[model samples]
Each structure stands twice: as C-alpha cells, then as structure tokens.
Target: MYPQVLFQNRKPDRIATLEEYRKSGGYEAITESLKNRSHKDIQEILLESDLLGRGGAAFPAGRKIMTVSDDAPYPRYVICNADEMEPGTFKDRVLIHADPHMLIEGMLIAGYAARAEKGIIFIRPEYENAARILEREIGLAEEAGFLGENILGSDYSFSIDVHRSGGRYICGEVTAQLNALEGKRPNPKQPPPYPTEKGLWGKPTVTQNVETLCCMPHILRNGAQWFKDLALTEAGAGTKIYCVSGKVNRPGCYELPMGVKLSEIIEEHAGGMKNGAEFKACLPGGASTRFLSREHYHIPMDFNSLREAGHRLGTAAIMVFDEDTCMVAATLNLLEFFARESCGWCTPCREGVPYLKDLMWRIEHGQGEEKFLSMLRKQSKYLWISYCAFAPGAMSPVEGLLNDFEDEVMAHIRQKRCPFKGGE
Candidate 1:
C-alpha cells in the first residue's frame, strides 16, 4: 500500500469535521507561516517543493505566486477553482466530500502568501453538494477564527466566499472563470497581464484548482525536501489522485505516489481490466488528452515521463478501453462532447470541432471515403491555430486515432462500415 497524504482522512461516508482536521495537523501551516514565514519564505519553499498544479496543466504553483508582484495594488484576489468539469475526472468532488477544511486552509495560506485578503471558491453548477460542503465548512472555520479578520492572533486576515457559478466546460480555464465571475461572457484570454497580474474586477488575482490548492497545506506542513521525497520519481513532487474508469474492476479515485507505473495502477491499484477484458488502449488523462496505446502500458504515469513519451498527464483521469471498443466510434464520442461544449469564441474551435464531428459522424455511419481520412488529418492541424487550448485538447483523441490506429481506420474505410459493427 502506498502512503496516503491527501486522502489520509478520507471517510467511506460523511465528511471529516473541523475538529477531525485539526487533530490531523490541518491549518497548522497557517500558524507556522504567520509566526515564522515571510512572503519570500513561502515563495521559496513552494518553489523548492516543485509542486506542480494537479489541475491537468501541471503549471508550477511557485511561479504563479512569484508573478503576483509584492507591491501590487490592494484587494488582490485568490480564487480556488473548483470547476472540475473535465470528463472522466472527479477528484475535486471526492476531495471536498472527504475533507473540506483542507481546501479552506489551503486558500488561507495562499491568500496570505499572495497578500490577498479575499478568496473565492469558483465552483460549477454540477458540484452543488460539494459547493455546499465547502460553504458550511468555511463558516465553521470562521467561527473557530481560522478565517475572516486578523486570523489566529495575527495581523493577517483572509476571507473565503463560495461563488456558485454558471456551467460551461470552457469556464474551467482561469481567465474564462475570472470573466464568468465578473458576469461577462466566459472566454479564454491570452496572457500579457496574466491572471496573477490582472484579473477579477481588474485586481491582481491568483487562481488555482481544488486539487492543487488541497496540496498546499500538506506541502507547507512538510518541508520542501519532505514533499519532494513523497514522489516515486525524482521529477515528481507528490502523490497523484488518479481517477480511474472504464473497463476497470475498481473504477474510482486512488491517491498514489507520483510516477507510479501505468501497469501498476491498472493491475495492482485498479484491480486490472474488468470481467476478463483484454486492454486495447486508454486515454491516459482526461478526455482531452491523446490515447496511450498498449505498447506504453508499462509507462510511468507522471508529467515528465508522459511528456517525454509524447503524451500528457492530463487530470490523471485514466479512461481504459477493452479490445472490443471501436477506435473510430470512441473518437467520434469525444468529438461530440467538444462540439457541444465549445465556447464558440474562435473560428477553429467554433467551426472546426463540429466539422470534425460531422466527418466522424459520417465515418461511423458508413458514409466515409478514403479522402475523408486525409481531409481530417489536414483540418485537425488547424485546431491548434485556435484562440485557446480547447481546440487543441479536443483534437487529442482524434490525433491518437489517426496516428496509432490508422489500420483500424482503414478497416472502416475499406469495408464502408465499422469493423466492430456489422453493416454494409
């Protein structure tokens, strides 16, 4: 069994109360920070810890903190991004249900480090229960003096608010979420003045996903070296909350050490493929990431390892598939999601995603031609030219299907029918 850090107190039923959290050294980091640490001190420790954002992007948390200038204007905002809308991902919801205080404590510490007095948990509509849990727990924390107005006998004060928000897949993006908070149309904005420099009512803002923030209390409580030592790989810093699904015996979240082998996760942790299913391929991350073929089955499920292998550790939401699954149909299903959830801000995504979806639709329904494959290959490249990462992300499984499973695709084209489905 791997050492549990984030899920240490995870209960089978009900939430861990404030008292329970306190007993397990929750919020101790805030005390330690107030008494002994400075902004630079916190920044340096975070940098040294090398805590990558667990929110799929893997951006360095320290760099984001450092970007918020120390002399930046007052009313700086720190946002806890709880919009866990990525398909096949639900780690955030699980984390909140297990222990909500960890997120609150993380926000407090982050707010102090960022010199922001206000913290907002920007949650999605689907997570109604998770949002309520956070709201109730936040009030409890305030009553105990962990939040609002000169916290814990110190000059530092931090307050958190839960912003139950409009649902959109694109709003999960930082800039888009900020815009949504301001009651504007949610759209991804390019960084010149990044969110850390200017955001949310034009004030300096620091935004982080729930899983990333949840790691803060633990990182600050343990020293940087201790945090680094938690990973199985030198390149990794901490354990990953892997959300496993599809064809697996235990389709749930497991907080395993970073850089654990994909085989180990599927075999030892996830109880292997379900009901004697033979593994064909898997979307190693969320729906947005490219598929990992059977050849890479033994690959280490880490950011560096996956990147080096021309893949991503996207949300770590491994969607496994059995041999019976059709690659073309699977890609089409993913495209259907991209088509519907598209923000329609840019041409490539607004038009390109649906066009691809249409092509995939025809192909699956036996209207595909030999020329359609090359046409797809040609147009899919344009998705990268879009305004945001969405188009590019949506193209992942398609690229994988074309790149790794061209034989399967050719089978469909030659037969004028899906190989897995009997049709003329």
Candidate 2:
C-alpha cells in the first residue's frame, strides 16, 4: 500500500498494456487537468504538493516551473530527463520498463502546465528495453489521441519525442542533455540562462527527471495533501524508489515512503547483508554520495534527514559495503567510472578525475604512501571547481573513503600491502 501510487501496475502482463492502465484509471489526472484546469491551476497544485526533484538535486519542482518565462517565445519545450546513468542507479529504468504510460501521463501534465508544444524523453543508450517500451507506448498514446495534436478534444496540443542517450554520463545533467539532444557534443552549460529561460533553440523549457515527472499524475489525482502525507518524514512529500545494491542480500529497487529508516531498508527490505557479512559502510545514494557508517544506519533515509546528516539522497540508489570488502578497491572502481565518464569539457573534471583514479588505483594496489594520501586529500578539495555536478560527484567517493576509511589507506602504507586483499 505504501508504494501503491507507483507500483500499482506491477503485474507483468497487466503493467504494459494501455487497456489495463486505462481500466486502472491511468491518464485520468492528465485528462482532468487538460480539460478542466488552466496552466496556472496546475502549477498551483504542483506548488502546493511540495514535490522535490528526484534527480539527485532535490530541488523544488514548482519553483522550477515558475522560472519559465511567461512570454518567452512560441513552442516552449519540456524534456523528461530519463538519461539515468549514475552508477548503482536503476530505479528509473525499472519504472520505464514496467509502466511507461505513467511517465507519459506525467509528461503530458508537465508539458501542459509549462505550456509546452513538445516533450522529449532523453533516455540512456544502455536502456534498450526501456527505449523500446517507451517507443511502443508513445504510439499507443498517439493513436488514442492522448499525445498528438488536439488532445482529449481540446485546443491544448503537445507532442513527445524520444532521444537516445549519447553514451555519456554528462548528458544526465539538464543543460548537457539539452546539448546532446540538439546534436551537439554533450557538455555542461553555465547557468543564469538556466534552461527554463533560454533552452532548445533559445525557447523557454522545463526539464524534469523521469521519476519526478512520474509523480505528477499521482499528485493531481489524489490531492496535494495526500501526496504530502505519503512521506514518513514530516519535511518530505511522496514516496521514494530506493535502489539497493552491493552487500545486500536482496539487491533491487523498493518504492517506500520517504524517511524510512536505513536499518529498515538494509535489514528488512534488502534482507540484511549477504553471506553473513557485517555492514561496514555504504554509499547511501550511489557512488556520488558520502558514506554513512553503522552510526548513521538509524537515520531516516529522506532528503532533509540525509542532508542534516551531511549526506544527500542522490538518486536514492544505495550501495552497501561489508566488513570483508576493501574500501580502497571499492573506491577505486567508482573513481574509474567517473574518470572515464568525464566529458573533457573542463580541466577540473577531465584532468582531476583521472588523477584521482590513478591515486585510488595505486592505493588499492598497496603502492600508496603518506604522500599519495596527502596528494589525494589536496586534490579532492578542489574537484568541486567544475562547471557542473560531474566533478563534484567524482569527488564524493574520495570524501567517503577519507572520512570513513582513512585507517584503511594508512594500513596500505603501514603494512606495505592492501590488508583487505585475499579475504585478509
């Protein structure tokens, strides 16, 4: 019942069909909004819902909508950012594969509210199945007159396009994705002309995360207060699809109320540690979030709680590590991914990430020194100087390793070998 809003159509056969979704009252919210509500009315409902972006930043959705210029130009655009390539993050992929129409309905609502003439689902290249599912569903919606010109017999018209990812992690960023969709090299753009003001051929645009958009129809269907009450935390609203990986026995996604305790997720939902291993630490939200040790296992896994605890709810993709796992190796693996994913657009990311990766490799291989650790510490402090969140995300694993496992780094130097190697 907790995740009913999202997992309502989880039955394999029933989930993928338009008829089932319609029978389940799918698209009713968008139909209602498009037919009865004005653009301002929809925005007001969103603002009152207190929904936050689920794409790592946790920014307010209503405020983002308000930033779009009321009279910018013709053909405003809305992009559903489905290019979810963050390491250990797969919640969006599951959502897309299981219930694509939910995303479509949500996009229609957002496009209508933003007064957008077009919408695009910029999905990841690796998600071939999801891309196929979306492509098929779009055709269905179009045939049903839910997507093409003149929807539900109204003047409001919106069209959606699917753009496959450029096989780069940078495209997950809002502006970077816009650049890629426009047939340019994917790289982060400087702010101030923040998409909503000047985007997609210099027209006003509103870009939203897939998961964020998926929540819209639910919010509109059940009042704003109902959405707010879905959270376990007082400060948060709605449910969060938490992705579990690493040391957990049952590593998969679970849509639970926000503010659910970390222990509940790890022990109850994830079925505790695998192979009887003890939990050492975890990257609470994919590779880019700070590590939380056993001390933080009791904290609520929500936006405000994680922030207050000096971490972020990044993608809500949790990567756990057991006692037997080597922190240096784990950190090195994440660094390798970030370093390779850098778009070479800025020196701080392109250059710094490789250097960080090399440092992690050396340390993981038992060739590290006090100087290497010092070099790592000094280099990581400046990784946040990049133009976008990429470099800063690259630095997150380093921060976690240093903060929670400095002793392991020192042990590599003191013992002249990786102590955790070969099962210690």
Candidate 3:
C-alpha cells in the first residue's frame, strides 16, 4: 500500500472535491496539529522527517520553516510556489490538476506549523485550469471554517489567497517570486535579507514549492519515522513524481520511490526509447542538468546519487535523446527557450544565451567552424559563472552536449549538414 499522502485518490484525473477530500482524512492532520501541537513541536517533527525541498535546490524545508518561525509578531505568511516553469518539468501541474485540495490542505498545515496567518498559492499563467481548480477549492475551504479567521475553533487563524504568475521562468525563484508578488518586475535580488526575514511586504514569510508543501499534510498525519521509511535511499526520503519526456516510449509523470535505478525508470516505467531508437544521452533533470550516457543509466535516481554521477537532479524531469538526434540541434532548442525566458536583468544572460544560440544554429546548418566551436565553449564557461542561476542553467545543455556528444558536433562540422537528415 502506498502512503496516502501522495496518491490518496489514486485515480489519474481525480480532482478531490472538498467533501471527498475531508472524507479521506484531508484536514485531520491540520486539525490535530492546531489542537494539540505548538510551533516548535511541529518544526521538530519536520526536521526529524528529513524532508528536503522538492524544488530544484533540494534544500531542507524544516530548516527554512524554523528560520521564519521565531521572528514576526503575528500574521506570518506561507507562500506555495506553484510556478512550474522549468523546461521538461510538468509534475506540479499534474498534482494540482489531479488534487488541488490536497495542496490546499497541505498549505493549511504548513501555515499552522509555521504560525503563519496568511497563505498564497502563486501559480503560473499557463496553468489556467489548475488556477481555476485551486480557486474553487479555496473558496469552499474558506466557507467551511477551514481557511479564514478561527480554524477548528482554535485561537489561531489563517487565510489563503491565489495569485497567477505572468509566465516568466524567473518567477519560480524565491526572491524573484517575492518581487513579482510585490507588483515589481520579476527579477532576483541580493539574498542577505532572505525571504524568511523580510518577505511579502516586509513580513516574515516562508515559500515552498507546490510539491514540497503538499508533502506536509502526509508527514504530519503519519509520524516522521513512517515518512523516512518510504525512501529507497538514505540521502532522499519519500517518493517523487518523476516527469519523463522527449523520445521516450512513455512520456508522462511517474510516482516512483526515491533511489530507483535510472535504467529501471527508463526501461520499465518509461518503456524505453520510441520506435527502434537507441539511447544516446539523457539530461537527468531537465535542460538545466548535464547529459549522462549509457554508462550512467545504472545510477540511482536520488539527489545524492545523481550528484555523484555528475548531474543535478533538477525537478526530477528526465529528457531522453536517441542516437539519431543531433546534440547541436537539441542544445540550440534549449538555448532558444532560455534566451526567450530571460528577464534581461544581467548582461551575461541576456547577451550570452542568444550568442550561444546563434552559434549552435550556424553549426546545425553547417556554417560553423572549429574556431566558432571554441569561442562558443569559452562563452558558455563565462555564462555559467555569471550572476544568477539563470545563466548557469541556460549554459548546461550546451556544455553538456559538447562534453558528452562531441562526435555529433564534429559530425555536423564535417558533414556540412545533419547526419540524421533523410532518416539516415
């Protein structure tokens, strides 16, 4: 039996109604915590669970909650970061669309644990259906005495709100998200004053990813020990919804236990490559992560395992590429996305990504030279070392392709055209 925390409904398209969700023990965790536990006690349970943020960074969620717990007078706030903007990452939307009430219940539990008085779910604009579903659910929760002013007749009170992002990738970053919520351009700011200290109109605020917040209700319902036992590895605890896409036979979101082998995920869960295609390389966690070849397919899918295998497990989105695919063309497609999504705040990202994209295009078209390749490599290095994570993420696919698929690049250079052309 799987933990009811993640897949309580179990149906692929089950959007839990407020009545159905409450029947399935949805608000029981929040009610129990609010009635019997203190803020410090809740924080202790979370810390014991060893729950790391499900967002790309994989930071400790309990530590983040503690940072904002002791400060503010009253009315501390929790923000659910639902801005699922990472390329090839679509699991958050799946969760929201399937069970928005689960997220609402989880956010309510987090607000209680953090002693926060207000909560906001910042969803991306492209997820219009998710936004709508959440909006309706929040309205129902509010009317039933679960959301507004006095929850379950306790002295503590919390309110929930929903805001839509303007379809920018940077809005997924914590600092930039704060800026967007404040009616400013969504650009990242210096982090000496982290969001825990001064966030959301200068109040104590803690922001968590949609998936991260949704895990809270389950952690509180089942003891921390039960949650820890769910992991397939030591470094990561709990199941993850891995989003597999691009050239795979089964391109969809999978709820697999952590530390499952990458090869198992591909060959079994994802049904391997499409057609008669042979695997060439894969970006283990979306376009932001580096490429891994057949040798790395045996690596476990946990964060630490992926890191040791030489890639960050970003959002657990694995984009597979077949042997017939051109690395140069694939990299160019990623660069195009990054360049278009850049906030243009810093020079390196604004100028550097487009420059790299242009070079890749020329190379794909057979107009590139050895000198152009060398220059592109140097520029990629510079961009990786630039201001924020945006540039570094943008540079990853290009650098990875060059390192793992150099022969493909050389094939493009020598053949004066794509070798995959005309199905040959």
Q: Give the winner by lDDT.
A: 1
- What is the per-residue lDDT of model 2 for residues 189-288, given as tens digits with 9 covering 90 to 100? 8987888988987888899999999999999999899999999889989998999998889999898998999989999999999998888888888788
Shift in Å, residue 280, candidate 2: 1.0
* Cα distance off (Å), candidate 2, residue 54: 0.8
Q: Write down the worst ten-residue block by lDDT for model 1.
A: 415-424
Tell me each candidate's TM-score: 0.98, 0.97, 0.96
Please estimate how well model 1 matches the true structure, expressed as its whole-model Cα lDDT: 0.91
lDDT against the true structure, per candidate, is: 0.91, 0.87, 0.84
| Candidate numbers sorted by lDDT from highest down | 1, 2, 3
Question: Which candidate gets the maximum TM-score versus the true structure?
Answer: 1
Model 1 spans with C-alpha error above 4 angstroms: 422-424
Can you list the residue pairs that collide in candidate 1?
Answer: none
Higher lDDT: candidate 2 or 3? 2
Greater-lDDT candidate between 1 and 3: 1
Q: What CA RMSD would candidate 3 show? A: 1.8
Question: Compared with the true structure, what per-residue lDDT tens digits does model 3 show for residues 328-369?
Answer: 888888888998988899888889999989988888887878
> What ranges in model 2 sit over 4 Å off?
1-3, 12-14, 422-424
